[model samples]
Structures are given as structure tokens and as C-alpha cells.
Target: MRSRSSNRFSRPSAQRGVALVIALVLLVLMTLLGLTSMRGVALEERMTGNTYDRSLSFQAAESALREAEALVEANRPTPAALAACVNGICGSPNPADLERWLDPAFPSPPNPGGWQAATQVSNGPISLTPQYIVEYLGDTFPCQPGNPASTNDCKRYRITARSAPGGDRSVVMLQSVFATD
Candidate 1:
């Protein structure tokens, strides 16, 4: 009897650390799970913020594109009217000529100092910045007689507008087409 009792007591004593080890392992696993969850939440927040920024940037770019299109359409109805559209001389109706319309010094109407325009010239050899460019797409020739033969001279004009959102310094480009009537 005495031997049995002593054996039982010794067994319990040896097993004392077993429960502690199991508990420690469980605690470490729980901590890792908690940390993982926290990281996931942080990443989600970042993605949401980035998505919002991109959405706003896209809207701004679209707005810029619309503004540019209006200018092009105004000039299109009558080439002679182009002169009145500008402060003075009509200049050229080509892409390079459009750059003059995007002066940063000129404030956009309805929202003073909210938006500024810059033109980049990208044509053969001239390398001038245009606020917008006019181009014809898909083999449609310009209805006007005696114009150069190219994809651009057709009845369609491609206007591109660029703007930086929230002062982030990242530029977004938006393009739209207006018909030359």
C-alpha cells in the first residue's frame, strides 16, 4: 500500500510541467492569431484609402477632359471663330495650337484657383505641349477639302486632359473625342 501511494504521488509531480507547457503553447498560438488578424485589418484600411484616392483622381481627370472638349467644340463650329476664342490671334487649330488654351495663369470659371491647366506638345518635330490634342480615329477622312492625309486630320479630335489630385503630384490623364463640324 505505501509503495502504491508513493508511486501515485510521484506520477502527479512528474506531470506538473506538462499542463504548463500545453498552456504556453496555446497562449503563443492565440497571440499569433491575434497578430495576424490585426495585420489583415491594417491592410484592408490601406486598400480602402488607396481606392478612394484613385476614384477621386479619376473624377478630376474626367472633369479636365470635359473642360478641354468644350474648348475644342467651341473652336470647331467655325474656324474663323477660333480667333475670338483666344485672347487674340486664332493661332493654329492643330494640337500644338491648343496648348495656348491651357495657361496655368488662367483660372477656370465657377471655381477660382481650384484647377489649373497645362498643355504638353506632342506632335512630329514640334514637341510642344498641348492641353488637348485633336485626332481622327478609324480611317475616317476629314470632310473638309484639301487637308493632309492622316488618321488625325479626320473629323474627330482626341482631347486629353491631365490633372493632379489632392496635390498628390500623381497626374491622371483623361481623353475624349469631339467632332469637327
Candidate 2:
């Protein structure tokens, strides 16, 4: 019964701004989701970078350990000569001496007391060349069966190596023992 023109133009007053409100709410939710995802991605990136730096430091320390072992094998240092620790070779570690490596001042100052630079190159680039120290742990006679002591004994050396990533963000230390006849 109503005219066709009037029906076409009729709209509910209550629904006037409903569509706009809905659109604005959706936009806000989407923005929040985007920001949260971005934060998660950034955190993952930082974690990955730290892991890489730590792995590099570990490899560098290992290389330094190998170099120190080679030195001990080649030189076959005597206990008497180790007292002076010439070129990173050291005598038995006293409590104070053992703590020296952990000291912050000892490494950067380049103390000649015991630390030695690694001559071998690492697989990856490192900010600091690794350093190591070889400590004479006395003699052991592994070949002589049943006899705890023997004149034919092998010299035992404990080598400790340390390396740090760029900016000193991370540090790695490794220890190994080498025995030579």
C-alpha cells in the first residue's frame, strides 16, 4: 500500500552509525595483532643472534685448547721450567694463581704471568684472538701397570683456553689435559 519511493528511502534510525563502529573496532583489533606479532619476531631475532655469538665463542675456545695441547706435546716442558711460565707454560696452580683467569683485570691487561695467545686461526672471524695457559699437573705413569709410581712417567699438563665474542658480550672457557712421555 505504501508508495515505492517512500519504502526505498526508509532506514532504521537506531542503525545509523553501527557499521562505522564495527569497522573501527575491527581496525583496532587488527592493529593490536600486528604489533604483537612484530614484537615476537624482534625477540626471536635477538635470541638467534645471541646463540650465534655464543657458538662462535665456543669454537674459538676449542681452537685455543688445541693450540695449547700442540705446544705441550712439542715442548715436553719440565716442572722446573714451568715455575716461570715462560710463554704461557705454568707450574702447578696455587689457589691465587688459579683464580687469576677468572679475574676481570687479568685478561684485558695482557698479564704475562701465565696467559698466552693462540697462534691457530678460528673457523670464523672473532673479535679477540683466544688465549690459553698450560699448567703442569705433575707426572703420571699410565704405562706402568700395578705400580703407582715409576721413573718412566709421563708429564701431565692442564690447558685452559678462553675466548669472547665481539664487545665481550659472551665468553667461553674450555679446559683439557694432555700427557706426554
Candidate 3:
């Protein structure tokens, strides 16, 4: 009969370190996977933050636009003043190509520069104070049949609002052509 020691089951001496090498390789691979996942999460978070900042800027700009419309509706500017759009608000248009608001290179002044700034807004996290400009389009007679006396007049105004968080990285520009009462 064969001795039990002669038939013993055991790994070869040459392969003794194979299990240890496999475990180390697996550890490295798992570490790499963890690092890649962390990077992806970080990138996603940055993108989300940018989106939120942009949204805040847009909201502020919208508020400025509404305030401008109120001024037009109230007819705050006199007929003479409307004829002479002073500051950024123009009663009479100078020239289409000369419009500063249409140009991106123009240097906008601080709050109340032209369009009134919105109030009650928290400039937190993202700080973008909004400002606006009003352009008065010429007056048009509403259905002038014959006598100009009986015809009503319609005034047109172009309001543009620029909203930027304090950083002004995400500047939001909005424009609307509003006909006044």
C-alpha cells in the first residue's frame, strides 16, 4: 500500500506566490475603478452648479424686464423726454447699427445705469444684479383715416435686460419689443 504522505495534495513550489500576485493585481484594479468613479461624480457636480448659476441670472434679468414694462405702461417719461431718449433710455432711436445695447462690446454701467435694478433679490451663492435699457420706437397713428385729430397714437418701446451673477460669467441678455398704452 502507498503511504498517505506520498499522495498528498499541495500546490507546486513554483506556483506558491500566484495567489498573492492575483490578490495584489485585483487590489490595484479596484483602486483604479474607484478613482475613475470619483472623477465622474466631480465633473457632474460642477456641471450642475453651472446650470444653477445660469438659472439665477435668467430670473434676475426677467424681473428687470417687468420693471421696465411698468415704467412704459405708466408713461413716466414725458412726451418731450420720450422724444429724446437720454441715458440708456432713448425717446428717439439714433440708428439701428449705432444701438449700444445691441453691441456686446459696450461697457455697461453699474445699477440704475439705465434700466432700473430689481430689488428684494438675494445675490447669494451667485451674485448677478440685473439692469435694463429702454429704447423708444417712434409713435405711429392708429388707423389714420383722414383727420389726424381723431386717430389714437401707439408708442413702441424696446426693453433689454442684462443679468449677470456678481462674477458675470453667466451673463443673460434678454430683449422684448413692447407697445405701450
Candidate 4:
């Protein structure tokens, strides 16, 4: 009869480290997954910060626009002064005269020729103060052809406001038309 030791179950020496190799592979995969999720979270955080900054810029621009409108309502500038664009009140009536407002470089550093800085009392975190420009779009006559003598002549004005936050990283601009009594 054969001895029990002679028929004992045994593994090859080469396969002794198989379990260790499998454990190492699993550990590497887990580490990669964790790193990927961390990157995703970091990206989401940056996006949220950008959104909030843009919202603040837009609000600052709107406040400047309202201030310009108030200025126009309080004291109307003469057409001659507006024609010369004195103190940011422009009445040139030429569409090209207002082209500078669209120029990215024009307002970033501020052009003393036309931009008017707003005195907005900001209670939030904003990088730069808002600014505005006023353009007179000429007078509008409400009288029809048959009623040429109608006394209602309204002066139309276009107000443009801009805000640059984070050193021009984000810029917000707004425009509105206002009529005077």
C-alpha cells in the first residue's frame, strides 16, 4: 500500500506568488480610479467659480447702466456738448462714433476721451469699478403727418455700461435706450 505523504496535494513552486501578483494588479486599478474621480471634482470646482464671477460682472454692469440713465434724467446736456462727446455724453449721431465701445482694448485701460466712471457703492467682491457712456440718438417726434404741430418731442439716448472683473478675465457689457420728457 502507498503512504499518505506520497499522494499529498502540492502546488508548483512557480505558482506560489500568483496570489501576490493578482493583489498588486488590483491595487493599481483602484489607485487609478481614485485619481480620475479627484480630477473630475477639481474641474467642477473651477467651473462653479467662473460662473459666480460672471454673474457678479453682469450685475456691476447693470448698476452702471442705471446710474447713466439717472444722469441723463437729472440734467440734459446741450446738443452741441453732446456732439463733441464731452464728459461721455455723445450726440454725434454717427453709428461709427460709438464703435470704440465695441473695441476690447478701448475700455480695458480706460480712454479719457469718452468713458465715464460710475460711482456705484459696491458691497460685493468685484475687481474693477463700472463705467458707462451716453449717446444721443436724436429727437423723436411723436406727431403724425396730419398732426405736425404736436408738441411732444422726446430726446432719445443710448446708454452703454461695462464691467471688467479679474483683470479682464471676464468682461460684461450692457446697453439700453432711454427717452427724456
Which structure among the candidates has the greatest lDDT?
Answer: 2
* Model 4 lDDT per residue over 60-151, tens place: 89989999999999986646523655666876455544475875554432566567888653645545588888888777645343677877
Worst 10 residues of 4 by lDDT: 104-113
Can you tell me which runs of candidate 1 are displaced by over 4 Å?
Answer: 1-15, 77-140, 143-155, 165-170
Ranking by lDDT: 2, 4, 3, 1
Q: Model 2 compared with the native: what TM-score? A: 0.79
How does residue 174 of candidate 4 score in lDDT?
97
Worst 10 residues of 2 by lDDT: 105-114
lDDT of 3 by residue, 43-123 (tens): 999999889878877888888888888878886453443353344566655564567566555446552334445543455
Candidate 1, residue 83: how far the Cα is off, in Å:
15
What would the TM-scores of all predictions be? 0.53, 0.79, 0.73, 0.77
The C-alpha stretches of model 2 lying farther than 4 A from their native spots are 1-6, 9-14, 95-98, 105-109, 120-127, 140-151
Alpha-carbon RMSD to native, per candidate: 10.7, 3.4, 4.5, 3.7
- The best candidate by TM-score is 2
Instruction: Look at candidate 2 and tell me the lDDT of residue 128.
Output: 57
TM-score of 3: 0.73
lDDT of candidate 1 over 1-181, digit per residue (tens):
3644456445443446888899999999999999999999999998897776565555556665666666655765322322323322132244444353355543343333223344432324322221333333322556555655533544465555554423443446676666664
The clash number for model 3 is 8
Residue 29 lDDT (model 3): 100
Going through the candidates in order, what is the number of backbone clashes in each? Answer: 7, 0, 8, 1
- Model 4: how far residue 53 lies from native, Å: 0.8
lDDT by residue for model 2 over 85-135, one digit each (tens)? 667777876755545467665543156766787854455554557888888
Clashing pairs in 2: none
Scored by CA lDDT, what does every candidate get?
A: 0.50, 0.76, 0.69, 0.74
